[model samples]
Target: MTHFVTKRAPAVALLIALLLLPACAGQEAAQPTIAPTTGAAAATAADTVADAATVATPLPATVPAATPLPTATLAPDPATVEAAASPAAPTAAATRTGANYVLSLPREAAVPADWLMNPPPDFQTRSPGPGDTYRFACLELPARSTGLATVGYRSLEGLPSVAIEYAVYPSATEAGAALADMRQAASDCIEFTIGEGDNAIQAAFAPLDFPAHGDDSFAMALTTSGPTTGDLLTHVIKIQRGHVVIGISHAAAASGPLPDTALTESLAQLAVEQIDALTGE
Candidate 1:
């Protein structure tokens, strides 16, 4: 069975304290490569999890609620990859609206026939806040008065797994600025440490140039691995259209360490068109 990691209410304080420690300076980002596997994808990761080592160290308490994230020594060129041109008009359905936002899924998103899209239970009621931990999630946007919604997909063929989040901000200006902030965050938080003891995982991200289907977009690949689990690579694509931002995070056992560029591009195209249609852009 394939396993997916769902978001857990993080110990916000602990994560903040850990992210403040000097990041591993000058650690070269790992090139995308197929990790060695001893068995089926799920089983190999499960075995690795079982072999984790525990150490004695008292957990810290009274840590500060906020800390500065270490900025990258050099910022990456955001336009490194020329974005694919925008797609034609979308045939997607009606837009879904919240108190202050509107959203729509790509009608041609290329979702497999059998894949189930399980949107979050609280998607309609949730609102955003300015928290540093959001940056750790890789493709997050930096905006005030935002709303977040996510949908998970499951399938039995091809790249069987994927998840997408739409974060809606109040205005196009804020959304564009937030997109730039996230791109910089991606560079600054290029690498950071998460967890401790046997569960410690070294995490790093590399910027990518994907077709910007909206007013602007940013893409990257993130890898987090440790002694306890097989290395996991997530290809994240973030698109900003006016006041809305769409973030896609996809991974598949069949695709090896990184997601196929063409596949992610198609997904982005679908989203960009639908978003454009939503706001009559």
Candidate 2:
């Protein structure tokens, strides 16, 4: 953050010099005096004339320097600065502090201390999927009217990580319909594939029972195996609240099928409460 500072002029210094000038002028005008009319006096008078000629002369009046007014400086807006720095890559701090796009969503303070929010794009291990391709580029969410905001948290002690993404549509109806389509896609997207040829990764998703919130909701557990990580599981809960669609993804090594843990359920419940508080419902 940059601080605003004002530059000041030397007006007081000038004023002090002006006040002391009169006494100095009197000393400059002093001249030696001598009595005349005698021979001895003539020599003294000649000396006085020489002394008077040596007396210093007074200088001309100087113009007072003009004093400038303090200039006002404005600090840069935090959002504008972050946008300029990296629109595609936002920090966890920025995600929580600068994400005012959704007024009714969870604030940064609501996030758990054990979780690290908004990992940088480079820090993420997963590649974009087919569903991700339709993000802001498709008919479901028109380019200008759609918005995406995400907050990610990784366990400070382990490999478990969770991310909450909000996708905003033009209206509640559009958002609701899109979420319905997503639930159907999630149901049918079992045993899917990513990458190409030998580098391909096999993935699967199974529906899970979760307490409903918002206008509509669905839960799923996704299992994927890759060349490097062996196998991993992600528990996902999708919720549609008004014109916004919220997707929370919780991932860890597939120790079984990513059963709904207390941490996962608590995080989801917190999001639901934050959404409700935000909408004043």
Candidate 3:
């Protein structure tokens, strides 16, 4: 989880707090890597029981609540990676109107000064969307030619969050075997625990029946919390040409039935749609 920004209500206070954190200063992607943002904060990230799948009103056409993505600082040095990964990708600055957002595509070669720099070095290029602003996920995954990275994120206001990673290798066999280490990490470092989820790591990856979205190839497991309280929320997205991974997390002040699923799914789809809209040229 790159950095944690705690939005106040709609996604400002905590979002700014996340942007102000020392851990997130300057971001870079001078080479092919899994530099994820975790973006800024905006929605109320507290956890609450959802009212079941209620028909959601599509986000306003005018994206209203996105934070200013920092500039990309494609630098090297593992220690400096955070500085390079904290900013946005190469593209035009996105706009907002109540929560809606949009961003430009990478194929244009015309990137905005404020948008995070992309094509970090060895990584391939892909457009985000044809617009100026868009929602996205910023993630930090294992750094290897091949391996599985346990990923999951949710946005504020109880939106749905989806996390899946892809690290290609020489062959499918190599890729499959290479992920063993990652499995160990997931086994050793990550664990699942139902109820209000808020810990150093997600107690469990929810959505028990997690489906492989379109080309999503791996057999995934899912889980969800009953409810809880939170005071902060973080918006983040990670994009790398062929594959784009996005997710979010909330830091509640209390524990109970709070609404956060809405924010999670909203952010997830926002970032995913941007990827789908992108041109992998």
Q: Report the number of the highest-lDDT candidate.
A: 1
Quote the positional error of residue 252 for candidate 1 in Å: 3.2
Q: Stretches of candidate 3 above 4 Å error?
A: 1-184, 190-214, 217-241, 250-254
* Best-to-worst ranking by TM-score: 1, 2, 3
Residue 123, candidate 2: Cα error in Å is 17
CA lDDT of each prediction against the hidden true structure = 0.52, 0.49, 0.29
Off by over 4 Å in 1: 1-96, 99-103, 107-109, 118-133, 137-145, 157-160, 253-257
Work out candidate 2's RMSD over C-alphas.
33.8
For all predictions, the C-alpha RMSD in Å is: 22.2, 33.8, 21.0
What digit string (tens of lDDT, one per residue) describes model 3 on residues 1-281? Answer: 11232222222223322221112112221211112224342332234335587788888678778798989987578867877777544332132111111232221222222322211112222222222221111222323232112222333332222223323333434334333333333334334432223422223322222223323322212222222213322222222323322222332322333334454344444445554443221
Using all chains and alpha carbons, the TM-scores for the candidates as numbered come to 0.57, 0.53, 0.29
Model 2 segments beyond 4 Å from truth? 1-98, 102-112, 120-145, 256-260
Considering summed lDDT, which 10 consecutive residues are worst modelled in model 1?
5-14
Q: What TM-score would candidate 3 get against the native?
A: 0.29
Candidate 2 on 8-54: residue-level lDDT in tens? 00111111111111111112211222112232111111111122456
For model 2, the run of ten residues with the poorest summed lDDT: 1-10
Q: Compared with the true structure, what per-residue lDDT tens digits does model 1 show for residues 180-259? A: 77677778778876666865767788877676678888877766665534455666677888777777776543225456
